[model samples]
Target: MTLPMQVPIPGLPARVRIHEVGPRDGLQNEKATVPTAVKADFVRRLAEAGLTTVEATSFVHPEWVPQLADAEELFPQVAALPVALPVLVPNERGLDRALALGARRVAVFASATESFAKANLNRTVDESLAMFAPVVARAKAAGVHVRGYLSMCFGDPWEGAVPVPRVVRVCRALLDLGCDELSLGDTIGVATPGHVTALLDELTGQGVPVDAVGVHFHDTYGQALANTLAALQRGVTTVDASAGGLGGCPFAKSATGNLATEDLVWMLRGLGVETGVDLDRLVATSVWMAAHLNRPSPSRTVRALSPTHHQEQ
Candidate 1:
């Protein structure tokens, strides 16, 4: 498919809100569990670097994600950090756990396809949405803001390309369920610029306010940055990213990390968009996290700026 050339949008907002998911979404798939102190410190550094919204941890079952087994302890430590720290709760049990730990914000997720929903949560789409109703109500009653996630919005690994209507349906359900905002995810990183534009256009046409939506893209095929630009042009002001470009879906086998926070900030700043994040500090944090994980960063900008062995000479 032929893609349109990206045209920079003029007169856009000077700053954008970046919801950092590194601590939770970013590390969930890692084989080694990050220490609680290390995780808490990572979050503190992120806040110190001007990240206001950070996903601190997931309150899912330890058996499902052993990496976050310390959620109970981790949440309390980070919750006192004086920032907007949200945790992902998969169901009522997770929500109850988060509430007991004094979580201020909670996120619930639903997949756009039957195959993905079953694979990721072992429930059908309707069933997942049904489970969120009481969770959202309980969260609202507790004076907590609830964020909804629609995974595999662009394509699913098992089912291939998903239809626009399906994505819209799931998004509408989440919004109707009283989520403060809904984040649409390119779960497998299969979205191109055209696909993103088309989806946003349809969603907007359906009367879903642009401000109520956020975009989450993966770099699996290297299209994440391009897709992000497309979303911005369409007036999406909120974005989901991970520090050091960490995270991928356990269900989407070949998926890569979420779009890197540094790369996104670099591009946004170049376009005169404000993300309220310090690029240099974020780069430093990414480097630290990558070292802790003992893996190379997936951020292109970070890799380019760092001196290689040849450069050191």
Candidate 2:
């Protein structure tokens, strides 16, 4: 009899919560518009496959992200799902739109690197935090849970190899601003295992609980899965991934998509960790989305497990 692949890493959680971001982060950067109905169906399928938290859409200006311009139409479709549907709000204006739409969970994105903040948000690092401060506070007062995303937590293409203290400072600020969870993002996929360990250790030293920290990684350097493993070993429970690796950063020039959910699920399952995700169903969802995007999924696991393959020119 053949044995199943099982590699147990020490001190890892028995289960992990995957925050699915394909419908939002993944689709925001697409060059083509994905219909709101298609986007809604995608989130519904993800929730049905056991992903509890799906980042539904961003309420940024339509000129900034024409792809997600239908946020108003999209939110109402998936808002009733039993899963947590968190939308990305760029500032207080975005928050107001979210509140009016009756969104119960939202996220505010910040950047650890000044270069990225200026390029992406047209503000300095401190200025962006100044922008998000009131948004997070008001959202909390309204009984909504906020997730804070710190981009370029490891390295920035403009500024190489970010220091741990810089990341910790921003993390502390976001927590102080009333964010219930922090998703530290390797926006350019420059983080390796050692960098991940040092940063997480310093977050502990700075009094941020491991449980309150999550990780978001891009596979620009193809290190997303490896970096996620390092985070998991350190007692980090929440992970951010897109179905079929369907994203790229418009600001971070060299960035690729976020880590694919299928790839992460495959590794987590092999390590004897439970994520409550149905792998086959997730893979099918990726394949379906790939057809709409007109490209083969960037996921290695999805490509390996897919029932159909389409050529990308």
Candidate 3:
């Protein structure tokens, strides 16, 4: 396998935490149901590959996301892993399911645009926040860390160009509700580097600390890595990525897959920014997963570095 030459960039963090979301966010969008056993192995592989934080699965009702219906069966399979495993809990009921299974970290999905809130959660922005408040509080009370995922932070399909202040207001609300961190999402993947800088600056201006912010960009416009670089330039260290570029928004037709972890790691490696991820092992893991899913990996780095790349070419 080949690797990028390490070159440190000025004004970027010395290390970044890659929040791997392949097992949950990635697989949830798949048309085929990935078996529970495979999902467990995927999580284990990610941990073994040095991803500290891996989102395991969602506790949402199975009818809504039939792909993650095995959250109950799957969490236990990898719960003993040394890495942090965060699960998505939509409401108190979902929180209950996760808590019962000993999930130490959970995430609540929010939308920066009303149109997306209505489409994804079937609630207005305020209503969805109201729904998450108790859940966040309960999770915190139980000594669990909570993450708030704010979707459509950059652009929305129905309501184009989401205002920065609107996103800050919701960020404040989620933080006030006891969320430890917020993952700002470009749900439609329309964000450019300038747009990313503007949002991060506005969030800081509105009193949201940069350390509590994470960027989750989709590759719809092929700007995820550029947007991520911008976020890093602004001192945002946590990033959300999926192995093999595995996920997209189910409710948002314009959305593409999440930023590929392999690609992100490759970039960070070249930048001499430590992510603690073993590139070779990570690529192999994704290749193994691509085989399980019966599709080629969408990740550019994975395709370029995998053992079968020469044959595929």
Candidate 4:
């Protein structure tokens, strides 16, 4: 399939969609609980950087993720922003909390591997989907857009390698249940470019529209960028990234964080894909967020651009 416009970079399509998940996914795993004001400011800076879609926060129980305990308060403030802010809803209770905050878009998550599904959500694969059906239905009825996340799509730490057919089955179920988009996640960052290509080929061959699929890759072995390029080659426009490379999976031991948004944007721009994101602004946001966390940015682009770190003439 051809894109609406010709992309300037070789081997890249015309346009790409980036879903910035720094505030939600990135900050959630931080050792320190970021102040609500800081979180709001971090999101505002991302918006200023020209990001259209941002995952602001998750409405899961505080006990599960102490960092997002302030979701109710934070949602209203973020909801008033001018961009698309989506929150993660694990179940009907979380969905109710999101709806109470007047959220217009919410995302539901499920795992492709049975071990991860049962361990993470306390339910089997099919049982988890059954639990999500009511949440999807209610969100649709409320005129809210719902995105589905399928974790461990490429490889699972517990199960080792997940079958492509299993991933396709979950994708089909989510799409059938009225999810606007399905985000395929490499939860453990073990996906190679060839693995990505194979999965995309299989999913597309299975009749899943390329447009409805989003690729979320982790940067464990520094292969996230290459895998992202592979997805782009397959015409998957939507990509999920975290500013400053902020989050790591607790379930997957030794797993690295999500792909850095700044680095991802840089690569996309170099490939002639229009992302509408300002590199300098993103760099500034990452630096600011890193400072708040009292840690250096995990983003390579940010490190290279740091004023103090730049080589002197």
- Give candidate 3 regions above 4 Å deviation: 307-313
Higher-TM-score candidate among 1 and 3? 3
How many clashing residue pairs are found in candidate 3? Answer: 0
Tens-digit lDDT track for model 4 on 212-276?
99999999999999999999988999999999888977656657899999889888876778899
Best by TM-score: 3
Write one digit per residue (lDDT tens) for candidate 2, span 132-213.
9999999999999999999989999999999999999999999999999999999889999999999999999889999999
Which ten contiguous residues of candidate 3 have the minimum total lDDT?
Answer: 304-313
Candidate 2 deviant stretches above 4 angstroms: 1-4, 311-313
* All-Cα superposition RMSD per candidate: 4.2, 1.8, 1.2, 4.0
Q: Judged by lDDT against the true structure, how good is candidate 3?
A: 0.94
- Models sorted by TM-score, best on top: 3, 2, 4, 1
Better of 1 and 3 by lDDT: 3
- 80-147 per-residue lDDT for model 3 (tens digits): 99999999999999999999999999999999999999999999999999999899989999999999
Model 3 / residue 194 / CA error / Å: 0.7
lDDT of 1 by residue, 84-189 (tens): 9999999999999999988989999899999989988889999999989999999998899999999999998888999999999999999889899999999999
TM-score of 2: 0.97
Clashing pairs in 3: none
Question: Which candidate leads in lDDT?
Answer: 3
Q: Give all TM-scores, in the order shown.
A: 0.94, 0.97, 0.98, 0.95
Query: Where does model 1 exceed 4 Å of error?
Result: 1-8, 308-313
TM-score, candidate number 1 = 0.94
